[model samples]
Target: MAAMAPSPGRGAHKHGVIALILCLLVLQREAWGLLCYCEGLCPDHNNFNGTCEAKPNSFCFSAVETVYDVETDQWKEERTYGCLGPDELGLMQCRAYLTKHQRPKNISCCNESDRCNEHLLPQIIHHKPSVAPQGNFLESLLLVTLPLGFVALLAVIMTVWFRYRQRESSMLEYNKPLGLVIGPNDTLSDLIEQSSGSGSGLPLLVQRTIAKQIQLVQSVGKGRYGEVWLGRWRGEKVAVKIFFTTDEASWVRETEIYQTVLLRHENILGFIAADIKGTGSLTQMLLITDYHQLGSLYDYLQNTTLNYFSMIRLSLSTSCGISHLHTEIFGTKGKPAIAHRDIKSKNILVKRNGECCIADFGLAVKYVSENNELDFGNNRKVGTRRYMAPEVLNETINMSCFESLKMADMYSFGLVLWEIVRRCASESGDRYLLADEYQLPYFDCVPPDPSFEDMHEVVCVRGVRPDIPLRWHYNEVLKTMSKVIQECWHANPAARLTALRVKKTLYKFHVSDGTKIV
Candidate 1:
């Protein structure tokens, strides 16, 4: 059939009709394709060869389009399209198509021009779901640990606080008054009452049968052991010497020595009676002796001055007292001789008749036995250092020996004489007058000598020498006294003069006729 030309109106209508029919055919074909594609590529299936495959649990459905380069043979992504239903297998297929064209199958694509082949498709992978742990696990652990840590911290703080409070309480208890009683039933008010009741009254003496008869008037003096009191015994005023409980041993020893010797002389301090009662807390022992109202030689000299005549009397009295101890009696077994270990001024007791007596033979020891001599051992450094002889300072000399005791006593007596002279000079204002005139006074009158840096060097090597003034009142008397002191202070024991010689020399100075001045 040959083609025939139609009129213009007819041609236009016919063209319009043909166009409408073409549009309707395209629409129908598209609808049918869409329905088939949706069914085949459901989420549960893989869209291949017009069949569905089982989908994974984590799959999603979508459509994708891609284009392929003719020369390179590589697919490239164009556009993405989405489906409305859950079709996991179809989604994977779409992802594979997109991957093949550089656009994932899980993503939608645009048109047919972007279509790609199966060889370039990417494999779709399934992943397991991640599980988060239970929310309360860490919270529960923290809740358990935090409270325990806080409790431990609180316990430590409380322990420290308790200890500090306890220590403070103990300190307060210690500082409380001694009278405060500590007992289970005692209260703070009770303690206060007890403390208030204890006043500053004299402590009551523990009475014994012997002390009961001897009535103590008042305390005269106190010593390391106990107090000495002025007491009356059978209408006679006597000094009752009491010993402390702590010094009971010393008291026993002294009693033994006194009983053994049975020392009885006008110069020697007489022991009247010992307490018949044995040891007790307060009245351990008591020794009765005749009391001298003049007190100690030191006190008498300090209080009153002696004229030249009285000084002579005092010297004669003191010499006679010391000589009696050293003198041996005709009837005695070995030797009735004794040595006063301590010969200071205070030990010399002044009597009412200006007579002197030797007292305090506490440190005295008998020189008759070899055992007595050895009792001192290597201990030569006994007695007061100020009155100690130079030979006594030397360790080689044994002080327990009679010869050594005599020498030590001589040295002490020399110091005593010096003390008496110094006191007399001071009372007469001679020391100050001499000091002003000649710029010289007795060595002891000056301030104490400066302390030597090396004490051993000074004591052992450089011996002490007293500085006596040149312009003294009686130059002859001063020279004699200095010579006597020097002889007694000799470094060698053998060189030192004896106590008998010292007594004789002093006697010659002032003693004349039967009468004396003390």
Candidate 2:
């Protein structure tokens, strides 16, 4: 049919409808756009402040954060205001992940009006001079005198406390025995059994005695929690991990984990004592253990190359330590299964007998099978970015399942194995030139210090991993090791090998004169 030409009135009505539709479209666009105030503190000390035009259905947000300043060794508060889209919580978590040292204190969102976030948070004012109060001479005199009296009283109390503490410490040091020796010919195992009788730690008196006699030599290491010192106790060297006052919780946690009944395995770091020592307002949290002169595996690998036998022994010993940690013992003095949340080469120490012992239990969690309970500790989520598992990087880990935690540990253990293999030399002493640098996992794909976003992008989004050298396929043992590493870090968390499985695989591969198992 032929299209009909509209009459004047009909055409006018059609044009009016078209104009109305166009007007509604413009109004809709205006409704979708909203202005919000934006400001932030960046890592480079740059100021970010401006008005942001929010996207469709977005909201304005105000956030306060606490960041640790490496240069000053202090925590600084940061305030930020900005527009956040539908994925608000996820975006905030990503930001937290990117900044390992920066943690969110408060984050609030509002969608009430344009510029709703303006002045939502207080700005940090630096170095504002205090104005002197207007007062007569007599009033100022009274204020000064009262404060002076208070200070004098405080000084007297402090002097008395100091003298008392000095006298007590001297007396205690004189009377206390130097060390707790089960017998003159007793082994470490015998000592451990005697000290911890169906309990997690040594007797309180024993801990105090050990702390009183140790003489600190020098600082051997420093970490986020505090410093580690080399000390001499009863003419024998010991490692003293001294926690800062702020890290009291971590000190307590590590001590509890280390003193787990039946946790004293040869491949695990030996716990000697835990004590709180000091005077007045300043007290030191001390964790005493056996000293390993070779230091951490990371430090040792940097300086020395490992032969095949040494590599297998180190790998097996580490696996054994982790397996024992995961194994739950049964009995009255039984130990619960444990998961080492932050497993890495640096946390593994090399002992004098050329074996590896797992150290640093600050982030460990214990699972009690009897009550079907898991103690998810209150420690901060801190793992080496390069060694994080896919589930952890993506924040999809099942926290309720104890097995999930063990699987994550296995993933990290696999990465540690990769590190060991990179430094391995042939039994015939043939060094692989390309793999000699002792590179960390994903070193080639990410930055020297990969941020959370960088790792998330590579590991979660793109699924990139450390490149396996094609040359490794030529050697049978190296090829087998590569296969094991690949299986350990499978993208699917459920597909990874257990610590026991890894230990058994390495044990079967070993052809050297080492202990049969951990």
Candidate 3:
């Protein structure tokens, strides 16, 4: 039988039915597409302001955040909602093994509804870890991270501009050369007082001027944090530490610590300027300070053998710096007690006059007795493993008590003093007996580049300390110095001598030895 042609009305009815079904399917897809409450949204239905629409191949995400109160050791909960971005290009490498996409541990993703995220149970968190990225994550992460970086840059610019403008306005009254000179006083602390009249350091105007005018001459040293360069500003030499963009937190923290009230001290490293320059990926954080040509105490000890007087002066100066940092100055313009968490020979710089100064404050922690607060700034860096105190190695140090931190520093200080004493020449009977060559603390007990577990075994579990030479016992000064080192590195932190006490004892030694203080 031959096929018959359909009537016009029938054909029209069939076409209308097909179009209606297509419209229903489109509406279903629109209903199912993931939409998330924008971040910072209260997640309350009645108070909804806006939402973030997930792009195709994405899901809505919700996260629970718990902010910590370091002072009180308390936590408070917060909520965040957003679209779960698609699998980054680098994440494609893990597709075969993993079914679920990577995200923050706290985040819960769903496609049920925009408010589905609200259904997630709030969990208390001390700290939130970022997603475990895989493959070429850095390359693929630029898409998401670049926007955050741009926002951070804008915030930094606004802060810098505000400081610049405020200082620029005051500059009309009086503009001094590089802030101030050392006048009659010989110390940089005097220079700071002459210029700003505060231990908070030079004015932002002076700092910016110095930063802008600085001419980096040669690379002096390089470390995990950054590179130190010998820079000059108007003929006066300065040390310019060039920090990578990744170390912004550490740089900012050190800058803040250096600017603390009454922070300037004769034995402390002088603060000159801190500036964030450049744009995009080329950003450089410059921390300018007074340059010491003699280099670090570690480098100095390696080449030169110190006499009894030189050792005393170095020890005295270093103790003074540590004491100043550990002591809290009270009043209207007061300074918090700071603990130099890392107190190795490398962190102490040698001045031209045979004195040493504490240089790095990146890992330093501040204690404010008024508020009962101990501020450990957001820095990922930790103390050197080789110099790690027993408490620190075993993870038994009390984070709340400031004294605990100070005691930990004393342990490291003991190690540094050991390094200094090792190179000291002591008079043995008729001839002078030169001390052993410079060696790091626990050199015999542990290997170079030790891990946390390795240090814990040697320092904490095994109960081993740097050996004291038998020759040190005969000389009066050397005997007293050995006792002080023993007291500083006591197995029990509570038994350790305070920085102030150590300073006093070292002063006594200097007086007994009949050597003048440097």
Q: Highest lDDT among the candidates is held by which one?
A: 3
Q: Lowest-lDDT window of 10 residues in candidate 3? A: 89-98
Q: In lDDT terms, how accurate is model 2?
A: 0.80
Collision count for each candidate, in order = 20, 1, 0
Model 1, total clashes: 20
- Candidate 3 lDDT over 1-518, as tens digits, reads 99988789998999999999989866765655556666553334475566766555566666665555567765456666656556431222111342223232365667665556656554645543242344337767987899999999999999999999987777644445444533442344444556755677776665776688789999999988899999987677899999977788889889989989899888999889888878666888999988999999999999988778889899989999999999999998889999989999999999999899998888889999999998889996789999889988888888889989999999999999999999988875766777788899888877888889989999888899999999898788899999999999999999998888888888775343453322
Q: What is the lDDT of residue 288 in candidate 2?
A: 93
Error of 1 at 282 (Å): 3.3
lDDT of 2 by residue, 1-518 (tens): 99988699988999999999989866674677667777662222344447666666667778777667899976777777777765454364213354556555677777667788876764443321122123345688988999999999999999999999998887466336434454555544456566535545555566677788889999999987889999987578889999989888788889889877888888999888899988888899999998999999999988877766787888889999999999999987788999999999999999988899999888889999899898866776577788899999999998778899999999999999989888876432354434467878887788898999999999999988788876667767778889999999999988999999989998897466542211
RMSD of each: 26.7, 34.2, 22.3
lDDT of each: 0.53, 0.80, 0.80
Ranking by TM-score: 3, 2, 1
Candidate 2, 303: how far from true, in Å?
Answer: 1.0
